[model samples]
Target: MSRTKSERYFFLDDADREAVQAKGRAHNRLGLVVHLTSLRYPGRFIPDPRQVPTEIVAYLAE
Candidate 1:
């Protein structure tokens, strides 16, 4: 099972969490994809499908 943003980044500071929540409200799918991919590739840009992992693509399809 995949962990939620809060579960995955339990140590996030208040400002970071608020920023993430703001992004969540603006880009739901993108947020999930970014969060999942960031676990493996931190500080990397994920602007589109070509940048994301195959596994993340499959998960997004569902």
Candidate 2:
């Protein structure tokens, strides 16, 4: 995933913060968002989020 797509799909806005926070763990939070967004864009879970682009992860982390 690119930074652009990550921002467009995986970017967790304030509205998503509460739900993501409820996940209660760093990996879970990221994984949830990644899984959700993946279903929207590339239309699949990408198998392993760790393989996600560094730029995408960095942008979503913001």
Candidate 3:
């Protein structure tokens, strides 16, 4: 079976949280996804192809 990516969230500072909420309330909406990337790998054999960057795929594997 295949594994999927998982995410962890960190809360913003009180002021930033308030500002985000205020903007959402005023606009009657929320903004786009502003987030970070976290990756996990499998046991010995298989590599996570998603985590590999385009520029140096072979070098990374070697």
Which candidate gets the maximum TM-score versus the true structure? 2
The total number of steric clashes, by the backbone 3 Å criterion, in model 2 comes to 0
Off by over 4 Å in 1: 1-11, 24-40, 47-62
Arrange candidates by TM-score, descending: 2, 1, 3
Query: Deviation in angstroms for 55 in model 2?
Result: 0.8
The backbone clash count of each candidate, in order, is 0, 0, 0
How well is each residue in 1-62 modelled by candidate 3, as lDDT tens digits? 11122112222345645555655443231220121111222223224444434322322222
Write down the lDDT of every candidate, Cα atoms only.
0.50, 0.74, 0.29
lDDT of 2 by residue, 27-52 (tens): 77877877776787778888977777
Query: What is the C-alpha local distance difference test score of candidate 1?
Result: 0.50
Model 1, span 1-62: residue lDDT tens: 24453244323446655556665454574565456546645555556546655555554433
Greater lDDT among 1 and 2 belongs to 2
**Which regions of candidate 3 are displaced past 4 Å?**
1-11, 25-62
Per-residue error (Å), model 1, residue 51: 6.6
